[model samples]
Target: MSDKETPEQRRERLRQEEIKNNIGGNLNDSINKSNNGNLVDLVGSLGWKGTGILIIVIILGYIIYSLFFS
Candidate 1:
């Protein structure tokens, strides 16, 4: 593989490195903390439509795994 990076590649590498080195503040704050910290309502915060799509994708993944391995 070629080892040399273009200008864009160098800039992106530095940007990612900066993000990696910075770790402070409420970066650890949970997004699903509303609804009195209830797991069900936290997921519901994604909206009914988004939650449905997430469930469908998870089911599809399980189906694909079973088809190939079973």
Candidate 2:
């Protein structure tokens, strides 16, 4: 199969590629910052583990409240 892109299609593809590269670069920068002892790095580094713990604590608190009061 032969595939050819029109000029407009090529331009759009390049634009999309640039956008993806920019986002990836920004993410890398944030990770690097976090690795260098920045407090904001805590969030970037811990990420889902921190988020999961927070959710679990909240759920447990809610359950305890319901069990004790109602």
Candidate 3:
């Protein structure tokens, strides 16, 4: 269909085009590509709340194992 686009749709289409045309605006050229990994990036990506929950789950698993199997 060749119907005229609304203003909002035109603005959104233009914004998408702008974003698509902008290359390497947030590219990290210095990042390591291998999976050897960095703990800081891993923990930071998870945020404090997620890290805390992970720690809690690990501690509970350890406690359960110690109480039941040892």
Candidate 4:
């Protein structure tokens, strides 16, 4: 088989590749925005004191659980 593509085929391939890249970029941007929004809401709700308490509780719970169960 010939390993050469026609001009029309090459143009079509490049166009399709461009479209694929654009769609992937747009999807990634949207996902990043969504994740950032969730993070913002979580931080806002927890504030500083709540976050600190949560971390301490989680660490203590982990230690207790590991000691008792695993």
Runs off by more than 4 Å, candidate 4: 1-39
Weakest 10 consecutive residues of candidate 4 by summed lDDT = 42-51
lDDT of candidate model 4 versus the reference? 0.60
Worst 10-residue lDDT window for candidate 1 reads: 23-32
How would you encode candidate 1's per-residue C-alpha lDDT over 1-70 as one tens digit per residue?
1379888888767754553454221122223355246656445344444456668988999999999999
Candidate 4 residue pairs in backbone clash: none
lDDT score, candidate 1, position 16: 46
What tens-digit string does per-residue lDDT give for candidate 2 at 1-70?
A: 1168788888767755654456545455555666676756644443455546656987999999999999
Q: Write the per-residue lDDT of candidate 4 for residues 1-70, one digit (tens) a residue.
A: 2369888888767755654456545344444655767755544344455456657988999999999998
Question: Candidate 1's error at 6, in angstroms?
Answer: 55
Off by over 4 Å in 1: 1-38
lDDT of 4 at 58: 85
Q: What Cα-based lDDT does every candidate model obtain?
A: 0.55, 0.62, 0.54, 0.60
How many steric clashes does model 3 contain? Answer: 0
Error of 1 at 50 (Å): 0.7
TM-score for all predictions? 0.42, 0.36, 0.45, 0.41
Error of 3 at 31 (Å): 18
Local error of candidate 1 at 24, Å?
24
The best candidate by TM-score is: 3
